[model samples]
Target chain A: MTINPKAKLEETQDGTVVYNFDPLIVKSHYEIDYVHSYAQDSEFFKALGRQELMGSKCKKCGYTYGTPRGHCMECGSETEWYKLPNEGKIHAFTTCYFGGEAFLNETPFHLVLVEFEGVDSLFMSRIIGVDTEDLYVGMPIRAKFRRNLKLNPTDVYFVPKA
Target chain B: MKNKGQDVYMISGGVTKFTKASPEADFRLRTKKAFDYALNDVGMTLKDIDGSVASYFSDHFQRQLMSGIMAQDYLGLTPKPSKRVEGGGATGGLSFQAGVEEVASGRMNTCVVYGFETMSHVNTWKGNEFIALASDTNFDYPIGGFYTGYYAMMATRHMHEFGTTVEQLAKVSVKNHGNALHNPYAQSPMKITVEDVRKSPMVSYPLTRLDVCAMSDGAAVAVLANEEKAFELCDNPVLIKGIGTGTDTMRLSDRPHGKVILLPNETEADYKNLKYPGVHSFRAGRSAAKEAYQSAGITDPLEELDIVELHDAYTSSEIQTYEDLGLCKYGEGGHFVEEGKADLKGKVAVNPSGGLLACGHPVGATGIMQAVFMFWQLQRTIKKHFKDDALQISNAKRGLIHSHAGTGTYVTATIMEAVK
Candidate 1:
């Protein structure tokens, strides 16, 4: 006679560990990695590895976006790559003592919005090699590219122009 | 926003106590509790709610997709048409507007808007990362663009251009936290002085730890209905007079400089030389407020509105919104706060419920919390809710509620009046 298949069961019938019991709370873990193309804006990150700062210029509005956009903000129009100057002036800045998990260990860092000459908008990056007290708006700053690029925005930062 | 549609009224509202972690109940149960309390307040039941709009900032915190559906099921609101809204910090405000539209459009006679958030799901640091995801993931997030960092930079520019001082920013913390002392549901109520705020540990420059709102877990509910049903449902009905929504580019730097959008109260010469909506100002907030006022038939907000419940994610932004909402001219917010213009006794009481700063910002729940507070304030029921008359805006007739997201991306300005 053929025996019926049996379903397997855990040795312990207890469920996942309950962190709390008043309302029955349990731990739920989640994490994931994302792989997505930068698409039209890929050129900006590539230019950083080549020691070049690239932005986008709207073909219709002639608005040069320093932050590099795929389209213009004033008038919705496709944009093209436009090379940016290495040196710019600080438009706004802050010294952060607290940050996200990715940058928490690197606390007390300066973030600046750099405005290039003739460029209508600003670009943001970290400012190293200067004290918080010394950083000021209108301070001349220049971009510094990493020799080893991680293909990330942090690959390019700013330093006070000597 | 005209009166072409049926007039909508906020019948009743309720909220759960705000806390860092709610061990007594999960997100869905918290919402149900708020819903039950709201229904009880008006002597109604779930059967009275025609539909619902759910608001929560992120699904990552709850770790549950279709959280709104789960909440609907738990609240016994299933099989009724329902939807969820996610708009960073503005989710609650957007959800309120969504429910109002339901009744206004003749689609439903009554609609319930509920919002909740469990920010304590992950560790504080991981939660910061989750909040940071609201920024452009590739451009801004990659450079460690924390929300605090963005506001700090903006606050710094405001200081540079307008001579705004850290002391002025500190006073905002003192004002908001002090106001929270009267709010039972407030998270970080303190009788803090400017010195205490200045001494608080720094999160970002010019913004001390006390200047920032702590993330928390909470839920709030607002029941809305048409004019006919409003009177039948409640004794003191508050009309939803006007609604406006505005948005800016996701990237802060992409914002283009333009002429100042004139509010009904201001003249062009008042800001002829100023470069509008710089990092120092929120252009989207101005746009939203302007539209709200236009629809509400308001000529001047500071003079007409009795109170304002605005998003104060940071102390500095509270000052910025004062200017955006036409309470004061641009570059005058710092002085306005220093002069005690935002106090309960001021021309128009601001954040009588302690706002996001002291009320505890639970992402999606914050805006609805503001609405709940406003509804109580307008209904002259503040003493009923707080058990004390210490926080009521005396003779409050009209008020405004502002919800903002990101640096200045999405903002909604909604005006409400106590309809006689």
Candidate 2:
């Protein structure tokens, strides 16, 4: 095979030459358009803005969902929004050393699944204010909401309860 | 039991060598190679195939869509009933199941099921993002939780609940890597100690870089035929005794955790320590295995099944799958591995093909590759290619193939036996 005469060649630190016939690198960025409507639990984030954790309780089955649901998954009944206790215990947790591009700056972050005293489902959020070694399952934690935040679950965090 | 349906058998299968990098090959070339290999294995050609099932997880990598048509056109198999299948990592097995059903239903006498992924063409960051697409975008992605973190959480929970140690988890990687040393198709076959695994850089806590399977480029294809056609066309065949598939909630938060306890006499502490059944166990795997065992009439898998090929994408997954597939009792997976029950010389040899952990995970190709490995083992033709005597299980009559997709959302379990 004949090599391209116009090929660009570059030398590496190890003295190895790399050839690139097509030096033009096309860069593109695209976004996935999605309409996220929190109609079921718009109040959930609104409550988080006020530093209060909230959940939905199924009036029919008495099942409480940590992340607010519009209807009961069990009986298909309308759910009632209720303020959840800020205090909960860690159901499970993991300390991530390598966070992807989105979370690269916040390396060594702790992601915990906190189960409230009465909630049926676990609430997953980042945990702060504790040594990584000290964090254990069933450790008491309290919700801490981010100030000046928009409608997102990451707006809330948990810390070791005093 | 009532009459199930027509019997289906895997007459032949083929797989390209798993590699971390294959810059020269693309999806079409890999598919054609795997297809031709499978056809040659059975002494057939494209003209003999009546139907085809192709699986490739994301067209984004290839910048193409309608992969089934693409494969069909590239293979020059015109007018053949061809379709695509996708179920995250379980796409290959799901495609195989579809092919089996197509033949069993008498719609097609012979069919080809194949899957491939050319992930090495893309950069690692882009590949990681593409893989994250399989997760629940609304919940998992926003929380900075991808596959590694998701599995790490499960590992942590398993450690807490069952006292499973990180060393025990490392033993899985050690054992799989040791098995891969004998596999010619494996990507990384170097043997390492449990201490090496623990010393490896932590991607997510409790799970190091070595614990996760490498992203690979490869393709695997299998030919399925009805009983009569299999008996007529091939001298020896691997019968597909049973196939089962099940799914769980898409989002991790919505996974079933059993019923909520409510009693007036219960203390707050009791509720705090309330243990749910489905936390560590993969419900989808359990459900699929249950159906498979029932259909195959297998009461004791550890005792009845001679060999197994499980989806060991992460070392933790393999440990958990031991419990999910009923190879051992719940919360005994760590002990199962510690006792050497899952070794090649153990009660039930698991992942004799080096598994995804050592052989490299090409996503769509993994499940089909497992079936290909099982087919070779049962047909006793594995030694021809692998040339590893220790890799072959002794008197292997029955084998099982299990694969899970998208954080336990989908599972496919297939039981295959050697036709005496």
Candidate 3:
């Protein structure tokens, strides 16, 4: 049985549709296009457009992060933008056979936690062009950037280096 | 707030049957049913409730900003102090502790903690998106970081670090779902085997569909009071021995490799090579357990705790939590499950109520349901509440209820003792 939301209820002309009667199921639609801001982390996303991964470094503790951070988590000091190497190693990964609505069409994808040599933490990203069974820990990987950027995290991903 | 030597007890409580969808009922109706059942269980009325703490996970599910207040008004808890508490999946556990604070502080004689979730309002995929919104939306969500993928990554790391086998993870599903057979309120009751679990369609690698919990709709109500008020309300009030809450970095990668917070029986040597709280373990859970055990005067949790109802949003998490709660050595969780140490007849019975795997993960109602089950278990009234003795542990003296959220960002542990 097919149900249509814009069926136009005969009893009403107020742009309403009923899916059921016993419980009176009504179809209500909601959608939004948020004008989001990256704020202080704007530089990190913008850097992806330049083929550069920008990590944050604590000025006081000399601690480094693989991902963006505005302040030092350990010393509570303000951080500065630091350039991250293009190549890194896969710390861990998993194959997601199911995902959210945004990524449902791209199901059965690989999500990896990439670790850097000098970085203190791992960075989450997708590993393209790699078979799930072929993926393993300590695998050599390099960051890949999209030619056209949208200031989104997906603009930067990881691929096998060699 | 500390207990401050003022004892608290869960005098009465009630829960609605969990299901995949309940289009006929909304959160308000569910809470009213549970609240009425709780009040009637003690032969009390709405007048007995001095205040309340409402718990639910997401406004996206209910599509109402102040759904808690709406439920409060529906319950006729008007003119009373009430506030909403949310810690993702730990909302129920946090609300229970909030009510405990109300009674223990001598502020209110009786406090009600009610929790519910109405996830059926959205499509399942959209519901996943709503839950994924709880992640670091900027970082994780953009890279196709589905919630299960995070857990799947952790499970993979656990497998790599400790050689935890897929069969071991499947054992958890088999055990938990089997226990749900006697639980009349459970959503998924199955007599499945490890092979059946392995054969189920894979959601993520190594995690079959059966290994995951269903999004459920239900509500639970727990009435708490100080000792004097507890006695006046009902007989066999279960004592709230201790309650503890802990948190970690919102992002898993941001967590530092800090030293393990040792329990009474554990030492630095137990985790000498273990890179403390890597993706393989839950550090906040251990912190919560450490504090809860201290006030409860518990030394050896594996032996001291008769039953533990924990957050098993996935089969693999149950094994990892066993290690965090000090039920086994950090890297020996797989062996613990393989040896049947967490079985119904084992040293400790974990998730005898079927946990989230079988009973379903109603988010906000899950932890309160755990406490309600523990309330009945400790009072030796499992026969009455469950209508069968299949899920009961013989001579259960004490039980621990755990609630967790995010990637172990927020965790709570509440210890309950029976009044012998």
Candidate 4:
């Protein structure tokens, strides 16, 4: 489907069109001209609609990684990006307390290091849709993409799988 | 006659310009420089190295991946054993230990250890978020615990526990800046005074902007060789006499005990008593140094050592090390620095090469960089200006290098000797 450049634009009184492309897509293309920076979209944000989340892994060393790259951390071999199994266990976690002007969230929220099967390193994410007090070490969980109410429609949060 | 000595010795060493960030020289180029420099410094070639080790989290600093391989390819060394070890600030130090094991265990006669990080290349908030990766991601990040926060907490705790004054911490900044004046490679070479330090903007409670080491970009390399090979390679081969490392619980709350003091409005005495309170993390540095001392056959580090290069990642960390490394008695670190005992011309010259405080701590390169400074001092590659001929500590017969990971969690120490 073609995105109409004029359709997303707002007509001004002077007839100069002001386009309203999604901030996320706008960040990836032209310079924002004058807005704060943003993070690149990841697989963690891709699975919110109900499919599985996958990351690229090195074929030679079997080291799984987030966001596909051309090489591996181990074995120094050129790597091709591939989909990884989403099921992982909670390795470590923490909760935040202090708030600053830039910090968008309130009070305390859970952040976790999720370790996938057969991978040595952990994947970091916010463990939503679960009670914070109930979490523990080695908890078995799966990945779920959750729609973020506060962010744009495309924004997603990684919730824990039961 | 059979000569008996400890298992580890540095057969090669390398370095790159200490900068905030290297655009043309990323982690890969810097690693290659250090690697080639180390090999050539030891009169060897890339083909002579048998294994490779490095310190890097992810290539988040430069937006690259597989830093280890990227470095290995830079050397054109293929199919050799290569691995990456990530331990935050102690990255370089831990990689040295790994290299030592590789050579000591007879797995390889020559191993290359490299630490490369372009910490300044990333955005400030993103960099903060990346460093927070060391903390409990879920709990600490959401709670606003940053790398500065963790070190700040340590500074606050140290102040409370030992009656350590902010002036004492300022002494660390002043002394390091004074020493940097003589060092050509130091990132911040201007002289700073205690008054200057006190007036600097406070970053986290007791730690002023001057108190913390800047994020630096550089690479350091070391080549470990067996005893016989070492003898043939260099005139002054620094022996890696002993190597030891340990990890404390990563979580700040999980750490045995200590509360984070937020309000600086409290009295000075309140801060002192709360800072270090029986905290034993410095023991990690002492333990590593003790083993290094024992292996090098030294009885008194105070009188016997010629030079010392300590991992002063922060002013507070360097002060803590004075107690941990047994350079002074317990709770006497502040007094020692206040009296100029650890000054380059004092009883024992500490960080004559200006240390990480001024030279910049580029994560993995820090430990090896410490070793390189010691090697240069031992070889007289870096000139030492002495006022009195009699006061001069001549020949640098023995040198010590110490480095630690986050909040003193991991430590690596090595002893080197100058043989004419």
Candidate 5:
């Protein structure tokens, strides 16, 4: 079990400190709906074949989001496909000793919060190819895609560089 | 604090022997046990209760908007304002506030608040889903955050920032468990040590299994009445003197500056004079305690307070309360425990009836359960070292009860006095 991010802390006059430690990480993953919706858009799938990451930018709010979407979350306006910043920064992450979402591989995956440069919101995914223990806040990372045999060959999952 | 016009007083209160399991028993039965225990405590029956409020943590156990009415009907209570209040693990304490409002507002002559849970019977995952509901769903839920994760983060942060050793947090468990050994109603009354806490399996980093409150099956009930009727209906009435409640932002991310500020170090004359990282209660709890103290005319909590029954839902919560309740100075909570100032026979007895760590947490029942402990302590009813005179020496005219909702977002602090 992890600590709640909202826990309280105290510091003493003698320099003793007390607080709760909660760590969580967000990573990038292709949610089924995201892959299914973009699979129909041949041009979007072609971008992944070239190892390029893509996103949708909302015209109404100028917001760029990772998940292929019909509408923008912020302004609720129709969004058009656009290439996203290839590089991102790790916002936060947590090491899971037990349990994982069904779609995720299994327990103990390094869940990372990744914020594309200059984006207000971040996406969650697994940090691959590195010892999760060494993961820290503000680690520079880039997106990669892994194709699933069951899905289209263009399907991709983001993995942080070693 | 002047006795406000809110004249709520406990006309009756009841609690079951907090246990790990009560198979086949639903909240309705558990609540009945507590209600009957309370009704008998006051020499009255359920029929006498003019209004009722039930506190439960999740809809899973009782299920539905009218579960309060369902539980009330099971008690054979007449048509009255049967309502429900939930505040995560602090549901019990929040229920006390609900009952207090009934009498304070003069809308009802008496109000009964009941809290119960049959956790052992429910699926653990489902139970967890309910507790996770306490957080801001939109932001926290997707992160797979729950009680363990939430508290673990806090524990981790506490260790990182304040250098608060895991052992100090464990000391709270050890001491409270020791106190629980004396409490017949406690669920896990076995003795524990700081070493035991350290060796225990980690739930989240820095927090061991012992540091968490046991998920148990139990029920607690309390009845509040107007001042005049309380004196007439009950022989040993514990008068409600002060009530204070506050709410902070719900999401941690929202409080970028970290909304949690430990109560101003009371040991230092100036807020800035005191050093950080000392013995102190979390700021939110101390705020509640300060409001209670001021209302009850208490200036020195360490010197003037008698027995205390606080929310120890986690070991750290209890340790922080020492500083919050002004029982000791900053960084002195650990020393206070080691020195026995908050022990059964110590200066200001804490959790003499055991705490949530040792006793059990039934969410809505917790706040009123603390009141019940204070009631017994004030009357010297317990066969413990801290005699009834402990309150007397501390000017013994008053007692304090503290409770909070989910990681200090909401707090309820109350002071009860022995009316002559």
Candidate 6:
């Protein structure tokens, strides 16, 4: 978790100093990791494994969330898991040409904000089986799940529901 | 003038030249320069400041913490109340508001609010990742919803709903950059056309590279005091007539997404319920502007306010803010800009300091920089400091500063009036 304080620095013609760190040394000294808990929505992903789109609805206000949550933000009521229809529409979308390391191989991919019929909030997912130029708002879409569920949101995507 | 007992005045303001990077300068150097400049502007020293608030988004670059204490120690101002404030990109405005509260509440007679950012130490990608830390990692990051993508989605939705065009968004950049031509402290002052913005490399769909604000390294400071001390310390003080802050949901998905357009004959209630989609920061800005205008007794912002400095992190944001701040009706942002209404010579001058589009956005410094621009503009001292007369808004008596941070989650709006 420490970088070398004495790393060699090189000055470029533009008067910018570039620090050169030994990758081996740097990697040996530090490790980046991610940790999380899914105690609230373990069932949500398990349902996704069966190609079922499940959401949570507040008992008080009947507000439905696309991404299942333990509590409803609007009514502060505990939510009950419910099955959502696979069909939805593209509320908004963008084709991102740049991303982090995890998405480097998926550069220039289309990310769509999809709104299920009667859903209160929108959820984001990648759009597959559709041409980028053909994407437009209000275009009908349907949830497309991966063969195997990894308990990650990326396990589900959307495509043109023709 | 309407808010009697709750008045806060800005005695002086200062800023370091915004640039792509400042490898040679660290927090200590940047804070010292900005602090000294602020003191010099008011002909006062550190001894005159009773409290201080420092704002910096991250210490990763400097590997330092307790920026307020460090700033106080660096300036040799000890045993004084000091604190640090951070609200992502709105850090400066929040810090400034803290200083205003400190003095206005009688806890301190005079206070200084300073904001700095040194992001050049890391590579561009790493820096972008650091910026992305502002988003909800569980949902946004995994889906590639970084700042550019977040705004790009909003832009796309705005275009889809309001028929806003790419050229209309480009006009914001063109106008701001043209304004920056007269600002020496701006990072990019080149004259660019709407076509140039359309041709720029795409970062996210509908958001070309030129549409985004430049990541910059800079620092800014403003000195605030109660009405009595303000008049005693400075000859031309800018009265802080009103201040407001608001927030929305951190996760973009939690908010409304589909388009909500308002008809021409719609009522305020109808516009509120119909036009706002809840995804953009317009709701937060509306809440903040409501509080600010109420305190300032500003019934009409487009008429009463002489100038405005919006947080144009991207071109689309500025256009959206116009509608959010009620400078124009909903969905008229694109036409407002295309018709030259937001220009320097237009009805209400916006981002006369070039805004973040051309002035550069150094995270923490941006809010204070906007305030500093307004301070100078209201004081009519732009020619004296920037040595440029064209950028000055003639007879600018009142101005407003709007800044937002996170994914449109935090917003701060302030109304300032010239008081000689």
List each model's interface RMSD.
Answer: 1.2, 2.4, 1.0, 12.2, 10.5, 3.7
- Report the candidate with higher DockQ, 1 versus 4: 1
TM-score for each predicted model, relative to the true structure: 0.97, 0.90, 0.97, 0.68, 0.72, 0.91
Query: Which candidate gets the maximum TM-score versus the true structure?
Result: 1
Residue-level lDDT tens digits of model 6 in B328-350: 87778999999999999999999
Angstrom error of the Cα, residue B359, model 1: value is 0.7
Give the poorly placed runs of model 3, Cα more than 4 Å off.
A1-15, B1-5
Candidate 4 backbone clash number? 24
lDDT of 3 by residue, A94-137 (tens): 99999888899999999988889989887899999999898988
The lDDT for every candidate, in the order shown, is 0.90, 0.82, 0.90, 0.65, 0.65, 0.83
Give the lDDT of residue B120 in candidate 3: 84
| Per-residue C-alpha lDDT of model 4 across residues B1-420, encoded as one tens digit per residue | 022333556766777767875566667777887777677666687667788787665466656777788787777877899888877777777887778878887888888888878876555556666666666543345445565546655555455445677799888888777787766667776588888987887655556778878778888887777877777777667676555464554544334223222211223453344333223236467567766666666767777777888888778888888776667755677788889888878878887767888888777788888777676666665553222232224667787788787656677777776655
Ranking of predictions according to TM-score: 1, 3, 6, 2, 5, 4
DockQ of 4: 0.03
Q: Model 5, residue B8: what's the lDDT?
A: 77
lDDT string for model 5 (B1-420, tens) is 343556778766677777776654666787888788778766886566788788877666434456667788888885777778877666777778778877887888888888776666444554565666676543354445555555555544444444566678888888788887767777888687789998987654455678878777877887889877787788878787777666544543222221234433343343444433211225556667777766666778776667778888878777667766777765556667767777766887777666888888766667777877776665445544223232222335566778877767777778777765
Q: Please give, for residues A29-90, the per-residue lDDT of candidate 6 as tens digits.
A: 22367677667777876787899988889988899987777899887999999788899988
Worst 10 residues of 6 chain B by lDDT: B257-266
* True-structure RMSD, every candidate: 1.7, 6.4, 4.4, 14.0, 14.1, 5.4
Model 2 chain A: lowest-lDDT 10 consecutive positions: A16-25
Which has the higher lDDT value, candidate number 1 or candidate number 6? Answer: 1
A1-162 per-residue lDDT for model 5 (tens digits): 988998888765764233322322122222234323433245555676666665677889887765345467557898787776767876555454432122123444455545577554455445666665576556788776655322242244445655
Report the C-alpha displacement of residue B184, candidate 2, in angstroms: 1.2
- Candidate 6 chain A, poorest ten consecutive residues by summed lDDT: A21-30
lDDT tens readout by residue for model 2, B1-420: 144578999999889898987756677788789888888877897777898888778877656678768777888876888889899988888988988889988999999888888777566656766777777554466777777877888888889888999999999999999998999989988689999999999988889988989889999989999988898778899999998787876656655577322222223454354354435667788778877888899888888899999999989999989887888766789999999999999889999878999999888889999999999999988888687666988789999999889878889999999996
For every model shown, the clashing-pair count is 0, 0, 0, 24, 70, 0
Weakest 10 consecutive residues of candidate 4 chain B by summed lDDT: B256-265
Chain A, model 2: TM: 0.78
Which is superior by lDDT, 2 or 3?
3
